[model samples]
Target: MEKFRIPAMRYRGLVEALQAEEIDFIDEAKEFYPLELVPSLEMTPYPHQSEALVAWKLAGRQGVVVLPTAAGKTYLAQMAIQSTPRTTLIVVPTLDLMHQWYAHLVAAFPDAEVGLLGGGSRDQTPILVATYDSAAIHAEALGNKYALLIFDECHHLPTDFNRVIAEYAIAPYRLGLSATPERTDGKHADLNILIGREVYRKRAEDLAGKALAEHEIVQIKVKLSQLERERYNQLIQTRNDFLKQNRISLGSLQGWQMFVQMSARSQAGRRAMLAHREAKEIALGTDGKLRILVDLLAEHFPARILIFTADNATVYRISQELLIPAITHQTPVKERHEILTKFKEGKYNTLVASNVLNEGVDVPAASIAIILSGTGSTREYIQRLGRVLRKGNVENKQAILYEVIAEDTTEERTSARRRGDNSPQEEKHKSGKLKVIYGTGKKQDLKAAEQLEINYSTQNKDVTNGVTDSSPKRRRNHPQET
Candidate 1:
């Protein structure tokens, strides 16, 4: 029979199809080489990791592994690399992760050549760790260079551009890893075709107290001031009136899409949109929430803490008010790295960030997480909770995630939805891991409020961002500020 060629992605399937038809051919597509690799250090695999590795091998070394963050997914990838022992390429979603994987691989396999392909550094080594952007741009040149492809945070692989990195690859063995694989846009469905079906899975709750630290979720509801409540109601009513007149429902995805499309075309729609945002801002950034945060910070003094907010404005506000280091998309890389390193070394005891630390970035272990505000996405919730779930140096450490919700507002519904509960009226709901604390954000008596003092870190320059902590010994009688 005459010989013909196929696309690099189709090479594996075409070979199988031809073999089924009793066709013989000599194909020349793969350009990867086998490596003689041995790990320099000795480590034992956790039970879940071992089981996951076995499942992947049973599935022909191609599939996704769904393990929660802090469950050591990176170490599992290292184990897979050792078992397969091929010229491998590990693709990560961020430059930070690429450097992390590059460091781990280099240390684990000292004899094998490990290189990085992102962050302006391109090295042609047998084992390469690349960012998604870099790999997708050089997909054609890298199509046949690797025999195995391991995608870290594989949930990001299904994008229109990133999928080509997998499609143009001639690698037969593939593995995908992620804490949360489901996407809001429904692009995750393509992962089954790009990498393979999910072969092993484990949730944060499933691995709690074993592979991860035992954790508790505490939801605190705070009331807005009387004036703030009145304003919030007015804004929400204005938005709802428009929604009712247009017969638009924000409960459904299509309804929200229609509202967005209509909001851009007319004056009434724009006002309605503005009203909705203003109402949400009032609920999410209430002063009562800040009061509770001051109390929490004083209560958990000197313990490593992470504060999350929905917007950069809130992040900066909290950072300035509490004298904690802040990280956001606008933060410079060098400054962000310095802040994280100081936090890890215990020089800075607390950090406040927007959504920048939710994924891809490696955060140090913390016993407490205070979420000032967030959207109704379970993925984001899980990622934030995972930040404090890593097993720390303390014995029997209990990680606590405090979700401060604005009472009698839309945020309550959002909190319920994120916790997989649709009914917000159920004040005391216990769904597996999360427990609600009713009315914890109520204003404290004046005497108690006056007694509240924040004991910041003694190393004033570390967290204050160049502001001298004159009263570092004790900040007493700190008035509640709006």
Candidate 2:
């Protein structure tokens, strides 16, 4: 009896309406889908996200948007697609991330048909989500239709990756998204043009305590047990006595540096260090992890948790021992989805994962993150922590980060990774002395990736004021752009 005026450009429940007519929608999506499209992911652009959208529209072309992971960077892409309603090509890094982006975009635009171009090419909806490899390989087929390009993990746009971007269907508009705009091999300038440098960056620290929940960064030190302590003491004594007999003091510069130098120069020194570290891990890290998990369970009982590890075998081993299933790349798709769904639904209290699942996915249920090992990248460290901080439960007061580092070895020294360029006034570090792997910053906030340029055929975007844009025009394809 009542007919209400509804806005044509913006219609509510459009996705709901289309999904209700599943068969009709699928046929419509496959056959002659209407020109007007609607997205699935429901979101009102955050103030900052809106800012990024404005800058992208203002640039009138291609560029990257650098924003913290949880700061709704994915949402930025959603808005960008709406702003530029062209056949859009989205490139992500991994399968899990592909699913994550797929889930996100579907929620963002319910009325629009979406396609997966990676291993499984299901729905070739106007909005296509594919891995970087697949996107690059099929660029030619997609060239004519694709007018808008969106790269999720832009930093990986380097030597091998520049191709996917290069052959992109000459999409007039491109958007690169990443956390940091820094580069390791002096490629920051190139990235300036590669994905549009420093377009709009919002730091984790800014969002951590407010936009996100407050957090406590805890480093758990698992000391050796009595038996292990005895073994460690014996080894230390052997090394100490040998060094003493040789008049080698471990405190001075020559002596201290010499210790590490000896580790490199002498096999015996390396053996001694390795044995010592073994005792330390057994005494502290591994056992402590078990204990801490129990302890955390009691306090934050029934809460969702993400356990991250650098070692895959160890992850599976620990998962088995703990009776919790471990998720890896080898995991079957159906099983992996089941695991994630169960965890998300609170059926499983804790989930163990490798670095593969760390970068992507939205585990709104995970309020706690237990880091077992890492390569000292603050960016990854922080990113892992961000996993738990996404808006969640009422009782979940703050995010928790538990780091287990084996003390008295290189592992111990680098456990608290030095992220960012900031460091206290200290000693000299020779570049070639050791394999230097730097942290992106916080364990939860991985440091920005090293820079690589976006080789577009058109003129470069400006990065002087911390922004850039490639004017929307057709130019000769550069062998380097993907």
* Candidate 2 error regions (>4 Å): 1-35, 38-42, 122-125, 167-169, 180-189, 226-286, 393-397, 421-482
In model 1, pairs of residues that clash are none
- Compose the digit string of candidate 1's lDDT tens values, residues 151-250: 9989889999999999999887799998888998999989888988887787777777777887777888899999999999999999899999999999
The top-ranked prediction according to lDDT is 1
Q: TM-score of every model?
A: 0.86, 0.68
Q: How accurate is candidate 2 locally (lDDT)?
A: 0.60
Taken over the whole model, the C-alpha lDDT of each candidate is 0.80, 0.60
